[model samples]
Target: MHLIITDAWLARSRAIHLSGTRLLLVGVLASVFLMLMTVSVYHWLVVAGAGEGGGRLGRFVLNDEMAQRERFMRENLDAMARKVGEMQARLLQLDSLGERVSGLAGVSAIKAPPPAGQGGALIASRSLTVQELDALLRELNIAAEQRSDWMTMVESRLLDEKIRKSMVPTQLPTATGVLGSPFGWRIDPLTGRSALHTGMDFQAAQGEAIVAAAGGVVVTQEYHAEYGQMLEIDHGNGLVSRYAHASRVWVKKGDLVRRGQKIAEVGTTGRSTGPHLHFEVLVQGVPQNPEKFLVAGRDLPNTRSVATKSP
Candidate 1:
């Protein structure tokens, strides 16, 4: 590079010369000065303006976005907490219901352990975390399911027991009567010889109604050589009841009958010597003492040992 200087009054001129290295150094210095000025102006515009609230626009926008996100999260947590509380209340109701049903079913219910006591000074109250709420919900669900299953089992057991009791011969066959000839060994009325009497005789008026001892299907309804005008009911489990010396038969073979239903009238149709109902209970064709079953739920007088001349 070269620069020329002229003096007007002295009429003299001077020339100055520069090398490549010096010219390059001058260019670098000018670039550095421009960069410094640019940096100073930017600092005055941004940093100084922030102190006067004009530069706070970006900060305000960022804070608003963060606040919205926090609000959404808090709302969801509150909803979850409320749900957990509802589930807990429902579980308590279920527990109470189960206990009542268990009592009606005549069974003991398995109880859960009581919760631990909780008490503290009210220092602070904080919202539950997602993890804590989820745990509570899971526990309540399991408890509810277990209680439901237990109640179902109890119901099934109760139903089965009821059916079994209905099939047993526990009802008296006659409405009004006194025990005439008791079951067991006795003298035959006609032959005057020792014999084994297989049934109990109930002394009632002629045309008195005779009901069934239990619920069953009538299997035999015909006249017999010894037990004339007889009707046999076949209960389940190979148990049967026979009513002998009936005056009139109301049910026939294959007809279903319920306990305490009228089926015949009392009379001496066969080898009986008087109008009396001869009721007999049998298991697999083996005769059982009718007194054992008839005595239940009744306030009948004790059978007298005095022998009577009857079938």
Candidate 2:
């Protein structure tokens, strides 16, 4: 390479010759200077796009990209907000269902742990961050799991209670009868004196089938001097039923009997005045009004009514 330098004050033009190492050094320096100029231009363009100097092409590209990013963020946030709203609505529905179940099951009161109280001044709302969304999702998941467990427990308890109630003695003892003598104070037919009637008398003809009111085991099936051929069923939970003054007994002691099963025939045996069934319900060792059980049975739409039949 050859280089020439000239100046107005110089007496004559100066010439310099470069070769090998010197030429290589000058080429490296020129390369470095060009690199520095390129870096400076790039930095200036970046600053113009980011700052108030928005006159360059870089500013337009950057604005378009930023607008797209903002739209994407807003759309995502709106979608998440809709999902959160749906979850909240579901939670409200679960609460209402829980309350109804509790009332029907006679749970008295459902006890839930009190939520921790929080107090804060209302502030300007902002977009939710990922961390906030994660926290909300975790809370909703925990609540849903808790509600599911509660519903399962309520269903189990309600089922058990329904089954147990069905086993209790609360049905008419005969399918064909009329109330002859009600429970409570009545003049004795034999003695002709005021006496406390321990049971209700169902007036029916002889040879009429008598059925068990509820499911139980026959605890006693024997003849009594005052009760005639009497039968007693031991329903569980300290409840029992006695069918007295029967013409004949069909079930034996220790025999399991289901509700509405034919157990005996109606007759006036022992100290009765006419053919009737003396039905009694006992709780523990005390006698309860048998009519109450029959009335309760009547409230059920499926209860079988007593009808007159031809012998």
Candidate 3:
């Protein structure tokens, strides 16, 4: 084949030719030489223009792709920054609301320590570090916890106050009953001397119903020499109320009674001059002006007006 190709090329002109093996070797050497030339060209280009790529694709497509990716990243970063700012504002709002609620709940002032990290501004506004933000969150949590605690305290106090408010005999038990002697220092009806009056005397017709002023457990339902056919109720909050001079007692010890419940009938018994109810409000076992707590001012409404509340 080489002799035939050489003779054919010699006939045509100076068409050099190789045998099969030499053709293979020359092809390999030519491939190696082309690879080296390519590498040298690449290095020359890269060294001459450092930032510009060696044999890079045209700038149009690659630059457009890079610009779009950068724009997308910038937009995403901007949105994330906005969200962070909104969350920070929300945290501030929560702090304000917590303060207001705490005030209404009668919570004491919190002794918060000073913040660290200079806590200086972000664009003229005090910026909080991650640590400072966490600290603020902790303080808010503590404030919220204290608010709940204060609400619980208020609830307990309100319960007791409501009980006390209800317990005092604020109105006449029987519609027919009217007060004869008021509570205070008064001339004794029998002795005619300035004596401390312990309770109010509600004069009424005999057999008329005597109603309880509040819901409570009956502590005493027995006859007494001074207050015959007496009924005493233990309303919680260190309060006790008595209904005396009852003709017939309907409640006994430990019996639960509600406001306006008929516990007895009016009677002229013991020290009473006629058919009447002797009502008393005792605080810590000592009698006080029942009128001060009953039929009083805005602290409590009239017994007829059940709208007044306490805490």
TM-score against truth, every candidate: 0.61, 0.56, 0.48
Q: What do the candidate models score in CA lDDT, each in turn? A: 0.83, 0.82, 0.71
Q: Which candidate is the best by lDDT?
A: 1
* Superposition error at 35 for model 1 (Å): 56
lDDT of 3 at 220: 89
Show the lowest summed lDDT stretch of 10 residues, model 1. Answer: 300-309
Q: What is the lDDT of residue 178 in candidate 2?
A: 74
Clashing pairs in 2: 175-306
Per-residue alpha-carbon lDDT of candidate 3 for residues 1-311, written as tens digits (9 for 90 to 100)? 24333456556634455779988998899999999998877555544443456425335445788999977866765565566667657655655665665565555534445557675556664334456555655765676676566556756766766666566566445554466777789998789899988987776789989888666899988889988889889877778889998989988999998877889988988887788788888989999776665556225444542222121
Cα lDDT for residue 183, candidate 1: 90
Off by over 4 Å in 3: 1-106, 109-178, 184-196, 204-209, 213-216, 236-239, 258-262, 271-273, 283-285, 295-298, 301-311
Predicted candidate 2 versus true structure: per-residue lDDT over 101-215, tens digit per residue? 7898766334556779998998887777778887889988888888878777888889987667666777788766577777799999989999999988888889899889888
lDDT of 1 by residue, 1-311 (tens): 79889999999999888799988999999999999998876565555544555457545666799999988998999998998898788878877887887887888886989989999899988988878888887898888788888988998988987666666677777765477888999999999999999999888889999988888999999999889999999998999999999999999999999877899999999998999999999999999998777655254222223233445
lDDT of 3: 0.71
Q: Could you tell me the lDDT of residue 136 within candidate 1?
A: 84
The per-prediction CA RMSD against the true structure, in angstroms, equals 17.6, 13.8, 13.3
